[model samples]
Target chain A: MATVVAVIASTHHPFYYRASTATGEDRPPFADEWVRKILTFRETLTRADPDVLVMVGSDHFHQLWLDNMPQFLIGKAPFYDANWYNEEREFGLPRMLLRGQEDLSGHLLREGLDAGFDLAFSNELRIDHSITCPIITLRPEADLPIVPIYTNIFAPPLPQPKRFVQLGRTIRELVESWPSDLRVAIVGTGHLSLELGGPRQFGPHGPDPEFDRRAVEWIANGDLDGCLAEVTLDSLHAPGNATHGFMDFMLMMGVAGAGARADHVDTLDLFHTMEAYFTWYPNGAPTA
Target chain B: MSRYLLNKFLYTVDRDAELVERYRDDPRGTVAWWEAERANAVLNCHTGEASTWLRFTDAEREALANHDHVALFSLGAHPFLTLTLFIAMFERDHAEPLGFQKQYAVRLAHFDLPYPDIAT
Candidate 1:
C-alpha cells in the first residue's frame, strides 16, 4: 500500500523557462536570479526524494476543451516523459526521467470519481510543462516516475473552491487504499498573486506580500476555503494570477487529512510575479 | 541556434493560428506569425507601457499553430491575452521589441515584442 510521503504546492511562471533560454540581447539581466530560485526549489525537492510524485496542477489546453474538457484528468501512461520538443525536433528535456505509474493513476482516478469528482482518465495523453518544468526542476535527471492529476482551473465552470477540497479528501482516501506499498509526493503548481495579461499585470510587480501572506496564513490555519477563494481569477487582482498552481496544496491538504504540519520554504515575490513555496508532511512526522 | 522572428514567419494555413483568427482580428499580420512564435509568444496591443507575456512549449506552440481550439481553454492566461498572443504570433512581419521593467525591486523583468514574452 502506498502512502503519500509529502505534499508540495508551488507557484508557476513560465517566464523562468524563457529566462533560461534567452540570449545576450534577448535575455533579461535578472535571469540569474530566476534561475537561482528555480534551482533552489529543485534542490529542495531532490533532497526529499519520494517513490512517486502525484503532480496536481492546471492543464493548459493540451487536454480538455469547452466541448470535451473534463473537470479532472489523470495521466495513466506506463512510461510518460516530460519535455517539449525544441527547434531541432529534440526534446529539451534534461532526461527521460519520469516513468508512468499507471496503477496508481488508475487507482486515484477511481477513488476520485467515487468521491464525487468528474474525473477523467487518459492513457495516451502526454505530460506538459505544468507537470514538466517542475518535475525537471526537482528530479533534474528525470528519473522519477509520475502520476499527473490535472485540475480544470484554466477553463471556466471549474471546480468550486469547496469542491476542490473535497477532491483532495478523495485523493487521500485513494492513496491510503493503494494495494502496494508505495511512497508518494504531491506537487501543485500555478501562482500566488501575480496576474497575467490584464490591467493588474502592468500595475504591480513581484509577489504581493500582503496577498501571499494572506494565502499562507489561510493555509497555515487550515482555512482551506479561504486559501482556495484567495487564488481564483476573480478574487486575484490579475487574471493570470489565479493560483491555479496552488491547487496542488489543496490536494496535499486532503492527503494530509486536515492535520498535516507544513514547513514554509521561501516566499519569493519575484519580478512582480508571485512564487511562494511550502512543504507539508502527514501526521507531523518526517518523511522517510 | 536559429532564431525566428514571429512576424517574418509563415505557417501552414490550416494550422492553429488560422483557426485562432476565426475568433480574433487585428491590424497585425496573420496566423503564421503567431505559429512561428508559439514557443515564446507575446502580445502588445494596449501600449508600450503595458503588455502581456506568454510562453508555450514546442508542443503547445504546435497545437496552437495547428489551430487546436481546445488549447485555448487549458492555458493560464485569460481569453484576451490568449487571443492577442495568438494574433501576434500569426501576424506577418511583426515582432515586438524587447525591454525591461523594474518588476521586482532587485530584478529587471524582460518582455518580447508585439508583446514580448516576458522572460524572468
Candidate 2:
C-alpha cells in the first residue's frame, strides 16, 4: 500500500535560484528579504522526505511547441538527471536529488493508465529550471527519487479546471495502488499572485505581495475550492502574473482527497515574486 | 475537434514510405510539411471522440516530412501523443478508409536542467 505523506506546491519562478546569493551575486532586482522566503521553503521540504515524489509541473518550449503537441504526459525515464546546473557558471544543484528510479516511475504510469488517465509515455527527458528550482529548494541534498507528471495548462486547448481536478483524484488511487512500501509526497510548483513581467518590476508595488497575501490566507483557512473558483488566466494575468503552474498544486490537492479542503502551509512575498506554499493531509485509512 | 482513426496516419506512412523517407532527410522541408498537415487536421476536426486518425493529403504529406522532434514536442497535445505510429493491416480492411489500425509509442522531452547528459 502507499500513503501520501505530504503534498506541496510553490512558485517555479526562474529568479528563485538565479537571484539567490548561494547560486551567485547576480541577484534579481528585488529587496533582500526574498532570500529568507526561499530559504524557509528549502528547510520545510528537506524535513519531509517522502519515498516517491509525484511532481506535477508544466513544460515550456524546452520540449514541444505549436507544430506538434502532447496534452497530458507521464515520464518514466530510468535515469532522469536534473539538468539545471551550468558548470561554466559554477552552479551547484540542491541536496536531496536521487538519480534513477525507473521501477517506481513505470508502475505509476501503468497504474495511471489503468485508472483511465491516458498518460503519454517517454524514454529520454531533461528537467527544466522551473521544475528544478523547487527540487533544489526542498531537498538541498537532492536525494528524493521523483516521478514527474506534466499538465498542459500552459499549452493551448488545455484541460479545463474541472477535468484537471478529476485527473488529480485519479492520481490518489494510483499512488495508493503502488505495491511498494514507499512514502509518497506530491509537490505542485507555481505561483499564487504574481504575474510574469508586470509594470511593477522593481520595488514592492507588484502582484507578488497582494497575490501572496491572498493565497496564504486561503491556504491557512483550508479553502481550496474557494481559491480555485476565483483564480483564472485573466484573474492572474495569463502567463504574465500567474504562470498556470499553480494548476499543478491544485490538482495535487484533489489527488490527496483534500479537494477544496487543503490546509495552507506558508506564503512568502519576495520582490517581484509571490512564493506560496500549500500542503494537504488526506483523511481516510492512511496507506502507510 | 474532428476525430479520425490513427490508421489514417499509418496508411500514409505505408503507402508513401518513399516520399516520407526523402522528407526525413530534408529537415527544413519536413517541418514545414508537418505544420501544414497538423493545422488542417486540427482546424478541420469536428468529431467529439477522444482520439482520431489523421491522413495527410498530398500537400500535407510533404509537410509531415519536414517535422522535427523539437517541433513535435512544442505542440504539447498530449495523453495521445505517440511518436511511433505502427501500421496494422487486415485482409479486406486494407482497402477501406478505416481499414488500418494504429498504435503510438510515447516520447518525452528532457527537462531543462543543468545536467551534463542534456548538453550538446
Candidate 3:
C-alpha cells in the first residue's frame, strides 16, 4: 500500500512569483519577509520527500466555464500546460509544464467514483495559479509527477463545505489504499478572507481579519467540527465574497484527519489576503 | 437577468489579447460587435452550432459597453470576472502598484453583504 507522506494546505497568492523575483526599486517591501516565510514553509515539504503529489486547487475561471461546470474535476493526462495569458498580463506568472502521474490519476478517478464523488475527468487541462502558485512556492523544482484535482470554489452554487471535507477524507483513504510502494503527498491551496472584484478588494488587509484569525487557529489545531459548525455556503460571504476557497482548507484538514494537529503552521499578512501554510505528517514527522 | 451572457463577454474577451485591447480602446463598439458575432458562440463548440438565445440584457450590455464594473457586480455578473477583465483594461493607467485595484474597490463601496446573486 502507498504511504501518505504529508497532508498540506496553504493560500495560493498569485503575486508571490512576481514579488519574490522583483529587484531594485520595483520590489515590494513585503517581498523579502514573504520569501523568508515561504522558504521555511517549503522546507516542511522538503523533509517529507514524496515521489508524487496529489495537487488540489480550483480553476479561477480559466478552463472550466459555466456553460458546463463540474463541482469536482481531476486531470488525468501525461502532461499539463499551466498558466493563462490573463495571469501573465496581471500577475507576471511564468508558464510551466508539469509531468502527470497517469496511474494515480486513473486510480483516483475509478476509486473516487465508486466512493460517490461523481468526479469529472479532464484528459487535457490547462491549470491556473491555484495549482501553479503552490508549485512555484513549494516545489520550485517541479520535478515530481502530479495529479491535479480541481474543485468548483470559483463558480456559484458550489458544493457545500462539508462535501469538500468528505472528498478530502476519501482522497486520503484512496491514496493509502493504492497498490504501490511510492510515497505520496497531498497538497492543496485556498484563501483567507479574500474579496476579489468587490467593494472590499485591495484593502490594507484581508476583508475580514477577525475571520482570518479564527480560521488559522481552526486549521492549525485541526478543528474540523468547529470550522464546519461556523462555515456554511451563505455564511462564507461575510468574510469575503471569495472566502469559499477556504473549503479547500477544510478538505486538507480532512486529509490530515480530524483532531490531528499540524506539524508546522505559519502565516504572512499580505495587503488583500492573509497567506497561510500548514503541513501534517500522518505517520510521524520526518526526523531529517 | 442573463448573468451568464455578461460573464461570457468578460471571459471570452479577457482571454484574447486582441479583444482586451479592442474592448479597452472602444468599449461601445466592441460590445456591439461581440453581441452580434460572439455572444451566441459556445466556447468549445463549432460556430454553426452556436446557441441562439445567449444575448445579454440591455442593462448588462450597457454595463459592459461603459466598462461599469460596479454595475456589473450589482447585476449578478461574477465579480472575479468583472474585476479581472477590468484590471486588464485599466490597471496600466495607474502609477503605483495596486492603485487601480484600490480605486476599483472605492467605485463599488456602496455595495453591502449579500451582494447580487452570482449563480448562473
Candidate 4:
C-alpha cells in the first residue's frame, strides 16, 4: 500500500514571500522571520523524502474565473508552470517544471466521480500564489513530483467544511489503495483569517484569535468532528472572506485520518492572519 | 444588471493577448466590440454609454474607458482582476507600476472594507 509518511499544513499569503525581501522598515518583524521558518520546515519535509507531494490550495482568480470556475479541480498536466506578476514585476517565485503522476491522477479522478464529487479536471492549468508561495518557500529547488488540487474559495457557493473533510478522507483512501512502496506527503496552504476587499480592509480588522486557537487545537488533537463543527462557513467568514484558508487546514486533517495525532504544532500570530504548522507521522511518532 | 459584462470584458482582455493589443492600440474599437458582444440594452442603460461609446456613467464603464484602477475596484470589480486591469492600463506608461496599486489601496481605504496589503 502507498504510505503517506508525513502531513504539513500552513498559511501562505503572497506577503510572506514578497515582504521577506521588501525594503520598507515599516514591515512587520515576523514577515521575514516567517519566511525563514517556512524554509526551515521545508528542510524537515525534505528529510521525510516522500516520493510525491499532494498540494491542496485555492486559486486567486489566476487560473480559473467566473467564466469557467470549478468547485474542485485537479491538475493532470505533464508540467506545471506559473509567472505571477503584479504590475511591478514577477513575484520572482521559482518556475516549477514539476512532473505530474498520470496514473495516480487518473485514479483520483475516477475515485472522486464514484464517490459523488463532480470534481473537475484540468490538463493545462497554470497555478498562482496559492500553490507557488508554499512550494517556492518550502521547496525552492522544485524537485518533487506534485499533484495539485484546487478548491474554489474565491467564488461563492463554496464547498462546505464537511465537504472538505470528506474530500480529505477520499484522498487518504485513494493514497492508501495505491499498490506501491511510494511515500507521499500532503501539504495544505492558506491562512486562518484574512479579509480582503471589504469594509475591514485596513487598520482595525485582525485575525480571529479565538477561531484560530480552537481550530488549531482541534487539528493538534486529531479532532476531526470538532474541526468540521467549528470551521463552518459562518465561523470562517466572521473573521474575513479570506479565512476560507481554514478549509485547507480541514482538508489536511482528513488526510491524516481520524485520530491521526500531530507530533508537532506551531502557531504564529501574524497580526492580520494566523499561521499554523502541523506535522504528523503516520506509522508512529518517531522516537528522539 | 449583473456585472457579468464587466467581468467578461476584463477576463477577455486578461486571457487574450490579441484583445489586449487591440485595446492598447484602439481603445474605442475594443470598447465597441466589447459593447456589441457582451453588453446588453439594459446594461447600456445602466452604464449610460452612447452608441459611439463616448459617454459612460457607471463606474465600470468609466474605469474601462479611462483605465481608472481605483474606479474599477470601487465599482466592485473582482480584486484579482482589478490588479490585472491596473496592469493592462498603466503597465506601459507608468514608470513605477506600484503607483497604480497604491491608488487602488487608497480607493479601497475610503470604504469601510478590509483591504489586502498587496495593493498598499
Instruction: Give the residue spans of candidate 2 off by over 4 A.
Output: A22-32, A84-98, A197-205, A208-212, A232-242, A259-264, A281-288, B1-120
Q: A1-288, model 4: which lDDT tens digit per residue?
A: 888877878777666656676667745567777866776677667767788888889887666766567999988877887644431243445445677776677778888788888899999877777777778767777787788999977676678988888898898888788777889888887677665544343323254667777877888888997777666776676776567777888888888878888877877666456777888888765443
lDDT of 1 by residue, A1-288 (tens): 776766777765555566677798978777777678777666556656678888877655444434366777888898765543321121233434468888898888777677777778888665666777676556656667788888776555566656677777777678878897777777777665554433234344544557667766665556665566555534543334444445555665665556444664666555566566667666344543
Candidate 1: list runs displaced more than 4 Å. Answer: A18-27, A81-97, A202-209, A225-248, A257-259, A283-288, B1-120
* TM-score of model number 4, chain B: 0.61
TM-score of 3: 0.99
Itemize residue pairs with steric clashes in candidate 4.
Answer: A198-B113, A198-B114, A199-B112, A199-B113, A199-B114, A200-B113, A200-B114, A201-B113, A201-B114, A201-B115
**Alpha carbon RMSD to native, model 3:** 0.8
TM-score of each: 0.67, 0.60, 0.99, 0.78
Computed on C-alphas against the true complex, the DockQ of each candidate is 0.06, 0.02, 0.92, 0.13
Report model 4's TM-score to 2 decimal places: 0.78
Instruction: At residue B97, give the lDDT of candidate 4.
Output: 31
Chain B structural similarity (TM-score) per candidate: 0.26, 0.29, 0.96, 0.61
What CA RMSD would candidate 4 show?
Answer: 6.4
Report the lDDT tens digits of candidate 1 across residue range B1-120: 111222112121213445335424531333445443442332222333422343345545554455442233233324323433433334333354211111211121232112222111
Ordered by TM-score, highest first, the candidates read 3, 4, 1, 2
Candidate order by DockQ, decreasing, is: 3, 4, 1, 2
